[model samples]
Target: MSNADEYIRKLSFNFTLSYQMPLLTIGAYQNPIAVAMPAAPLAAAAPALAPGQGDHVFGDVIGTIETALQSIFGGGAGWQTRMQKYNSTLASLWTALTALDLGHGALPPIVNRAGMAEPDEHSHMFGGYSHRFQWQLCELVATGFVAGPTGANIEVRVIGGATKAWRKGVMARFDDLIGHLVDSTALAFYITSPTVIRHAAALVRHSAISLTAAVAYTTGHNGPGKLRVNTVLAQYASLRIAFESILLRLENEGGTRAYNAVDDSWS
Candidate 1:
């Protein structure tokens, strides 16, 4: 395999491992609200309480608060469904990306000077002395060409460019999904428990705050919780950087075509 082929394979693998795999666990984390306040079991015997007393008013207030909490946090069913859908989307994306044929074999060599070329100096030196030169002997080997893609090569470039644009769109959707997960998880933590908020406040150095760090602390607070939100976020961060690096490599090095946003076809 050529360098381009190897690089493409490596990038695809990195995206699968770092971006898609970790994303599968984004919804696995236990809802902090559920953990902090579990539903109470029904009492075997009801204590006789006077009407409009302290305990009666207190129970009413608690019941109202629980109802509001349920409304905000949901019952975890819808969240699970959204997660499954995102995971399915990622699986499909992986299949399409892996199936793409971005190999260097399709591209024509930049320098195609095959036939022999007798220099003017040689002709001037030997006017009548006609000397036959081998095709390889007079071949001109050039580094870079100043021409656009043409012929069959254009198809290869179009596929590559389109795939890149499609991947970018998928990435943007992925970001939105992750952001939703993070924000929901963080909100749960903020409302259900003060531990995460206190920890995050302590960690804040200057005026700027890191929500990622807050989520990480919450997930890592009591050992490795059910949700792996921190790992997902970290892996996604690395994946973004790796993706940009892959684009840079394709642009600077020859062989594989770089993304052409102007002429890209999302469909």
Candidate 2:
């Protein structure tokens, strides 16, 4: 097969495998979910920022409290960096696709080939661009991830192009394409399934409940009905507790271990 054709085929294959494998193996097979624990209320650091005598304190205490809060939550820099990496990868893919002229086979490489070096950046050029053959029209369907500016927003601005052109019949073309691309990229980049923030919250809850149940069952902390509830709680805690029994025996003996559908907090 021609190099451009080969590249597209490979990309498509990669996309499908990345997106489908997780759903089939993890998302489908995994049961129960992890729920996030609510943040504990901050104890009174000192008093208020307002001034006071021997008992009262200055604004410094307030500042300290603020600092602590920032330290706890503001260090998501790693997540941002990983997102940038994903974006950069998408950008590279965009360059390749454009260079290959995937939109149409007949069209020559978008970038001129004259002299200087390289084999179509992947064998996209043919006979030094003297001849061009048009192939099937390539249309990328984007997922919301693109519009949401996921992966450094590369999926949208870099890959989808500054101006997206779709068939006239399509009304929600841009929105639809963005959604597909984002979902696909999230899967491809993180090896995880696409998920809404709500899913994460739900998973966190489920996991906690599952875990608590498991602990209760082992300890015999409740009656039959109460035992059933504890089992559910135990399953929720599976993300932390590795023992499968802790998750299973706790909640109907069928606890689930679900990965966050959203891109990993790291990637």
Candidate 3:
């Protein structure tokens, strides 16, 4: 088999294995769905990475993956640099998704007060039964429908209300960003070998699909539920595992050797 064929096979195998591997936990916030209601504004439990920390991590992952692609599909001068530009964009997209997840989790629970109303002794004057009223109040309070003074206060913040629309906008932008990267990569590979472009394109598509699934599972809920939250976390873990697998394969196969080589017509 040719170099490209061998590379593609390795890529496929790694991706399959990675998909089945255990979920990855990034920092303290392993589960994006489990964002706690902050006493202050909604913020991820893990503080933002210090200044260049995020960039360093993004660079390591994106740089390795792009280098591997360069090895398999030769690109014109500066192609790798051009591809690396998307690293920061990808980081931004991740940040946006995390923020949206946290914001959604922090929304106040919707309480229905009518169900909590009880028909008490006073209700007899209104032609109702006292026992029924007394019983209903106890049930509602017990079930958390009625919050006492010391109970957890639920306030609907203005930001919480706008999260739904904000989420839509974030997802839309994610599509655009990923779409651009795919198109750009395809163009780079097309200049070298049209057939090889298919392999590169497929790799990107798989990665994109994983990430899109993560975003979809996250946005699937406007409010938190146990099952939905778990789904979102699982999807994210899958995405991380997939990328890490690719990076590992690239490193083992000496893909970084192509980083300084320029032999295509992508310019």
What does candidate 3's lDDT look like per residue over 1-267, in tens digits?
Answer: 555434434533333233312111221211111122112211122221111210100001233233323322323464345334423343343333334221124431111111222212111111111122222111101000112134532111000111234234333432332222211222222223333213211122111122344345335534323243344344344444443343333233321111111121111
Ranking by TM-score: 1, 3, 2
Error at 223, model 2, angstroms: 4.5
Candidate 1 lDDT, tens digit per residue, 1-267? Answer: 554444434533333333211111122212222322222222222222221211100011112222322222222344223222323443233333333221111321111111222122211211111111111111111011112223111111111121355345434433322222222223233334423222222221111113354455556564322233333333344444443343333233322222222232211
Q: How does candidate 1 fare on TM-score?
A: 0.21
After superposition, the stretches of candidate 2 with alpha carbons farther than 4 Å from their true spots are 2-4, 7-223, 241-267
| TM-score for each model | 0.21, 0.15, 0.19
Q: Is candidate 1 or candidate 2 better by TM-score?
A: 1
lDDT of 2 by residue, 87-190 (tens): 44432332332232111234211211122221111111111111110000011111111211132321110011111222221213212221211111111212
Q: 261 in model 2: Cα distance from truth in Å? A: 22
* Candidate 2 to native Cα RMSD, angstroms: 29.0
